[model samples]
Target chain A: MDVLTDEALDLAPCGYFEFTDDGNLVRCNTTLLEQLGFASEELTGRNVETLFTLANRIFYQTHFFPLLKLHGRAEEIFVTLRAKDGSDLPVLINAVRRPAESGFVNVCVAIPVRQRRKYEDEILQAKKVAQKALEENNELITAKEQLEAHRYILDHKLALFKQRNQDLIQLNRVITHDLQEPLRKIMLFVDKLRLDEGIRLSASGEQVIERITKASRLLKDLISGLREFVTFDVTENPPSSVDLNQVVAKARDLVIRETGFGAVDLKMSELPVIEGFGEQLQLLFYHLLSNSVKFRRTDLPTVRVEIRSSIVQDNQFRILKDRYHYVDFVRLVYTDEGQGFDTRYTPGLFQIRKKLDARTEGLGFGLAYCKKIVENHNGSISTESEPGKGTRFIILLPFRQSDQAFI
Target chain B: MNVEMDIIRRSNVKVWGSGSRTLLFAHGFGCDQNMWRFVTPAFENHFRIVTFDYVGCGKSDLTAYHPDRYANLNGYVQDVLEICRTLDLKNVIFVGHSVSSMIGLLASIKEPDRFERLILIGPSPCYINEPPDYVGGFERKDIEELLETMERNYIGWANFLAPVVMNRPDSPHLAEELTESFCSTDPYIAGRFARATFLSDNRRDLPFSRKPTLVMQCSEDLIAPLTVGDYLHRNLPNSRLVVLRATGHCPHLSAPDETIQVMTEYLGTPSLN
Candidate 1:
């Protein structure tokens, strides 16, 4: 039952090829030649990559060769060969490397797997779609996890803020009631000593009494200022559309009546109506006007204060763009011709205890009150000043505040 | 695991031989460090030989494969440099094959004083042709089809090898044993590696590397043609191009004698330093 070896190889059912170690084709079976529709001369002397499709050429170099070199054999390798007419012939190839007289030779046998390739292509297409869906699902899960983490952080911060707010209210009550009672008694006793023992007291004793009265009065004013500062945050006043012209007029009259300085030259431009607490805005303006009058130099005969306002886009402010979502903001510039402090003190100027000058009458709560008021309205305030020069305050307030703006 | 041990396990690093000078061999995209078996023996007596499988290939710890980190050749470069740093290898001779040639070049550029010289085999700076200036012997469509072929073959091997792998759960080395007959990899990871290898463009990085380089190009390489070799020679500032008589992409595997002969001749020349 032994057949001729050459006849058996040439007449095999599957395609066969043998190439040198360099991949130059030496011989191929008749079945392979007929499968590719090529003459022996077309493929015999050419590189084996020429018989493969462009993709299969890359596969041959990157995978097929390396496998053969490493393991001496490669099995069940899927590739596509190109026929002479430029059609792909999908094949399953098994190859082995052997030592030859010259160097090495690679022998491969390929079976046309057109039917199995068609089924595999369908499965691959389905798998790609499934993989894409899985990737999208994974991305969604990641995004949801990030959102949950952010929510947890925000909730924790809100709880801390509420606790602090409760503590502030408790402190405000103690300052208003317990501290003020003893201070009132001190003022009454000091008055009684000045009236009842006036003739018996020596001149130096009268001078000491005058100091006591002045110190007691200053203490009273400080307690009042501290009360205003702490109590303003406790009140939950809804925001309303308040006209700035009326607010500034009322604040100016209060400052003039309190300080008894009638030589103020106030100039104001048309102001915009904004959403804010009316009383707080009035207090904000009062602090600004009083600060100018109290800090006025004796050399200057008249205090000149100018108020200018304009609408600006959010982009005009580099720092506040990310803080607020408003489309437009009302920018107010308040300049006063008074004795300005050194510009170096501008950073801590708005702090409650940062008194720049010792000669000022009241506690240094004027600028602090102004900052708190502006911030409560979801606005920002900055000041520029130089010694002996005038001071300018720039306040930016949104035209309409969102509900979340109220802390 | 500690940092040094983690890297060693993750990359499946192997070190052998005994000498003062070191030789680090980085394999290309398709296979692992085992591909260098035929060539490493020749240099064992004179050089401290080093080899490693990139993450996601061979017996490397597959759990360390992160798609975001391994999305490009830079990730593979990090694998090589980490191995060198862990071993405290200095003044190394880097021998890279295929895509790894560019990866080694980039690593040398990043750490300029680490490598003494670079020996690149069957290297291509870019695989796609930019017509009117360069011919890299591949088209964009050709790469796409290559990916398709890889997917098909990967699915075929996964189906065939699943039963063998599952049945030998007690044998930790059984998977490696089964995959020894071919360059087996995770299908998903292999797709990404193929994309990174074929779509990379390192043509601009050639002039920056000042290390002495030896470019060993095969005569009839389908991946890296003669034109690509000439281009590399012209672009690399301090390099010598030697066209090997051997053919195919892996000349060391196809003709180890010729590959080692040229390397020995080049290393013997004292002027390269």
Candidate 2:
């Protein structure tokens, strides 16, 4: 019995074709014609390349043909065949070359692999999605590390500031206490000379004693003022909510006690409560009120302290942060009809040891101390003054102190 | 380091025939050294013959198929040169078919002392039409269609050879062994060689040929038409053109008697004259 029959070749389970070496289709099995949805006569003598998609056709020409020409057989190559309606069929191909009378003949067969190809595409898509998710996770981790590094640097800077402030406070306490002991001794000796030996002393000597006494008293006042300024480090005091109205009443009482309330007229308005260093805020109010009393024109002195509350963005000011878009704040406007100085001295007016009037017997640190206190509370203090008309002081205080609000 | 061994290993070089002078044969893109089996026998008694597969074709090592090296015609020329150098061949009569004809021309130009003459059968310098000046027979789309046909045939062969059991069929006159020897190729490597062959433009290389050449143009070749043969003949300084009354690209396959007669007439004359 013959192993291969003509019937078996034509009716094989897979698609089969035979073409000349130049690629003209000479014969095709019924199975191949039916698979491609074509009649037997429709395909004969046509180029076998028409059975594949364009890209697959190019692959066949460049790779498949050259291989078949050299080796006489090609096996199990992945390819896509086009059906009659233009849909694609994934298939694997195998071919053998045979020499004919004129040229060469190529016998080929195609097996469908559409189901396996679909499974492969799904695996590729899943791998791509997982890769994208991994990349996003890496980005998030990098961002978190950057934020942590930034916080660490800020913490280091804040620590250094605290240590420096502590050192300055300690030095100031020593200087004030040690210097005051000698100043008290000088006052005691000057008083002894005026009281016990007054009958025997000459008139010129008496005049010298008077001058010495006056100079010693002024030195005492300046030294005490310097002590007040050096001790005003806000870092030493814990923050708390304090009423500005209460702070104002206390400052007014201190000012009136020093320079009797006989000539000057002082008026106060209702003020809002704010979060700050209580002791430092009280000192800020005291220094500002005293400046108004001391600088009064003496003929018709007028002083009014007006306080108001509102919400404001920190950016409105030159110094405070606008990081937190808006914050609760208290504004104190202190106006006085006093002997205001020249505007030329305004910039230095709030600097330590800046005296506008040398004749007045007062330390120059009052305004500087007030400015420092306002700053410690995360607020601002500024003054507007005319030479002989009056002076108005404006103070803005934020309700909160933490720098975190800015970011 | 061993250049001779490398070429022998890569190209599967085979030497046959017996004579003082050597004749080297290079196969074209589609088939290997077997294409010359019908023609080489006629000259075996008169001249020594050398045949070899191209880099990625026939029994040559497929591992040596580097796409970059084989992307241009120069790489194939290198294979021919290596075979000549390895065998210590001089005054070689080089016979090339289709794309291998360009490969032989380039080799001769590089090592002129080695080759006495070149016989280019069905050779085309360019396969696509350049419109105003040249028409190498096939259009770009036509070659594309031709390639498509080649692929489908390959796919069909692949399916037939797969594990499915089938009854073996036989044809008259064609023995089982002889029939099995036809069109055996590695599909992956063949596609690359096909692209390198058809898409190549060797028109500029024609003018530089110094060796006496024989351009064997087939009468009705769809691959290399008559016009390409004329172009090569006009450009080559020392060359002769002969149109064979055979049909198709491989005249050696279809019309071996005519291919042998024309090649013998050209090579029989002395070069020193």
Q: Please give the DockQ score of every candidate, comma-separated.
A: 0.21, 0.02
Please identify model 1 stretches exceeding 4 Å from their true place. Answer: A1-5, A99-101, A146-407, B158-181, B271-273
Over the stretch B181-260, how does candidate 2's per-residue lDDT look in tens digits? 34336655666677777888878667657798999997766577787888888998888999987756677865678889
Q: What C-alpha RMSD separates each model from the true structure?
A: 17.1, 32.4
The candidate 2 chain A region of ten consecutive residues with least summed lDDT is: A315-324
CAPRI class assigned to model 1: incorrect
**Per-residue lDDT of candidate 1, residues B201-241 (tens digit):** 88877876778999999988878999999999999988999
- For model 1, what TM-score does chain A reach? 0.58
lDDT comparing candidate 2 with the true structure = 0.73
lDDT of 2 by residue, A15-60 (tens): 8888776567888887877888987667756777778875566456
Docking quality category of candidate 2 according to DockQ thresholds: incorrect
lDDT of each: 0.83, 0.73
The numbered model that scores best in TM-score is 1
